[model samples]
Target: MSDVAALLSLARAAKARIATAESCTGGMLSAALTDVAGSSDVFDRGFVTYSNAAKQAMLGVSPETLARVGAVSEEVAREMAEGALARSEATLAVAVTGIAGPGGSEFKPEGRVCFGLARRGQPTQVETVEFGALGRAGVRQATVAHALRLLAEALG
Candidate 1:
């Protein structure tokens, strides 16, 4: 929670209004940010695009991209972040899509999360992280922490 508070402070200092686009973690990333006191000024909105339709309708993620790379890919994550910035009053947006589960295939394993960081007027960045078989809750929590780190690095 202290990390989250410090993150809010960093956003405050930079005047970076934040938005989130989430998938497997549900709204946990947004929940973490909003759980901190005084986050309303920094957090503009959150998009919980749990399904492909929601991703397309809410975040404007491309159907072609989803068809080619699937929902958990960096391509989708990038679109989600870019879409968040496009739809929100926020200056900074973060997106996460992943499989946090007790089951996964050989290609995309459990505890695999993709993240995107988009800052207005700058190139959006995307990355994939393998937390490696951590249970559902652990992976989700780790994803939130890593997303916060990405936000901090972007803020810096």
Candidate 2:
């Protein structure tokens, strides 16, 4: 089965609901989850916070955190996950923020993605990945796969 399908299966088995907060990947994560049959039972909602303002307004990612660490940082990802969990009726939440680009600075290179996962009663988890110049679509696809894996792991 696909990673998204596997995640949906696990979530359904556990009767857990999920939410997503996405930045560079846009709504691809949400689209992937909803692509599965009968995902509504397990998939709650999605926040497509593509901008710093949107992140703050939609997912409550603090402006201070954004200023301190930037949108692609682990801190913002964690807050996005936590905020999604708090705002939605979901039992679990996953977040992704990245610079999936053909352009990147010397410091934050292209294909550098940050992820966050949160379970209702558990500590929020954050991770950073360097996919290394995979281009925009490639990096986004990789991010979706990793995000699904994180959700599946949390379901376990």
Candidate 3:
């Protein structure tokens, strides 16, 4: 069984639910969590906000945050996590934003991923990871894995 499945099982045992807000990794994180049997008890919903406007409209991410930090920054990720928690019954929410690309830029290069986690009545936690030069698919997969781990940690 995948670690995500185990994490979901733990969450179910604790009577806690999780929600996901994803970008770059798309809905893969949600897919992974729900892939396990009986995940419906633990996973509440998922948001696939690939665009800044979508993030704002769907998760209540601020336009100011997007303009200040871009779509793939810690601010946006935190806002996404907070919004997901506010919008769902889930006790924990995870958000991912990044540029998983084959092309690199001087500032936000390829394989740059940011993650955020929000818990009920708690401050949102945000972090950034750079996978260096991994290709698009690899970076995305890694981001999904990291997001799952973050969700598990938040659940605990």
Candidate 4:
């Protein structure tokens, strides 16, 4: 089984449901999870909040966090995950934000990603990663893979 398939197995065994909040990956994590058969049993819902305003309006991300961290930081990702968990009835949630781009900025640059995972009754975990200057598709694929791995880890 693929690791994602394994994650579904774990979640099913634990009777847990998961949700996702996505930005740069644009619901890719949710797409991947739902690509598997029987995912509806373990997957709850997904949010695609590509804009800072949508992040605030939909996922309850603070405008202050967006202003301070520029929508692609660990703080926003954490808030997205927590908000997804709170908004959905899922037991676990994952969120991602990044610049999967051929264009962006000097300091943040391309291929910079942030991730967050929240499980009900547990403190949320957040991390930031730089995949350097990969091609846009490559960076997005890597981000989805990494997010799936984090989801599997969280379920365990």
Candidate 5:
């Protein structure tokens, strides 16, 4: 699951294309996926929705949802994943939103990330990972790693 090449191969074998919707990690998930050679067939596209406006405009994340639970919540992550899957030609999509930061409140701590995985004709799943104060770079790197795992698991 940590191996990007193996994950890509799994997707290709399943004929599953991938799309990503990222917030705190920016486009790091997309970069990780495309880092491997011959990923074009399985990696479809990515949306770096770093802002509330961008999330609404690009991924169709509901303004109401954002206002209700904020961008870092499971609701927003779920919407982002579903939105990405609906907007792309890909069969599978993953979304992430969180506070990978040097600043965070008690409600949402630093290194707290929410992930959503959506596959065609299947129920979308969401989970929260409290990576714990792993500095900014560490949180982001961990996010990309976990995202790769999510993609690999989704292939099954």
Candidate 6:
């Protein structure tokens, strides 16, 4: 089975609801999770916070955190996950933020994605991965895959 299917199976078994907070990948991660049959049993909601304003307004991502580390940083990703969990009735949340593009800076290159996972009664987990110059679509697909894995890991 696909990663998302496995995650939904595990979540349903555990009676866990999941949410997604997405930035660079837009709602792709959410789309992937919901694509499976009967995902409504485990999927709760999704936040497509592509802009800094949306991130702050929707996910409660701190403006200071964005100004300090930018939207693609680990700090913002963690806050996004935590905020999703807070704003929804979900037991678990995953956040993705990154620059998936043909354009990137020397410091924050393209395909550098930050992920955060928050589970009820558990500490939030944050990670940064470098997929190394993958095109925009490629990076987004990879991010969705990684996000699914993160959610599955958290369910465990």
Q: Clashing residue pairs in candidate 2, if any?
A: none
Full-model lDDT, candidate 1: 0.95
How much does candidate 2 score in TM-score? 0.97
Could you tell me every candidate's TM-score relative to the true structure?
Answer: 0.98, 0.97, 0.96, 0.97, 0.97, 0.97
lDDT of 2 by residue, 38-155 (tens): 8999999999999899999998899999999899999999999999999999999999999999989988999999999999888999999999999899999999999988888888
1-156 per-residue lDDT for model 1 (tens digits): 498898899999998999999999899999999998789999999999999999999999999999999999999999999999999999999999999998889999999999999999999999999998999999999999999999988887
Worst 10 residues of 5 by lDDT: 1-10
TM-score of 5: 0.97
lDDT: the better of candidates 3 and 4: 4
Task: Please list all clashing residue pairs in model 1, or write none if there are none.
Answer: none
C-alpha lDDT of candidate 3 relative to the true structure: 0.89
Q: Write the per-residue lDDT of candidate 3 for residues 1-156, one digit (tens) a residue.
A: 678778977797778889999989889989988888888888899999998888999999999888887988899989999999999999999999998898868899999999999999788999999987789999999999888888777667
- In candidate 5, which residue ranges exceed 4 Å CA deviation? none
Candidate 6 residues 52-155, lDDT tens each? Answer: 99999998999999999998899999999999999999999999999999889999999999999999999999999999888999999999999988888777
Candidates 1 and 3 compared by lDDT, better number:
1
**How far off is residue 19 in model 3, in Å?**
0.4
Candidate 3, residue 146: how far the Cα is off, in Å: 0.7
How accurate locally is residue 123 in candidate 6, as Cα lDDT from 0 to 100?
A: 94
Q: In model 1, how large is the Cα lDDT of residue 60? A: 99
lDDT of 6 at 149: 85
Candidate 6 regions exceeding 4 Å error are: none
Clashes of 3: 0
Give residue 137's lDDT in candidate 3 (0 to 100).
90
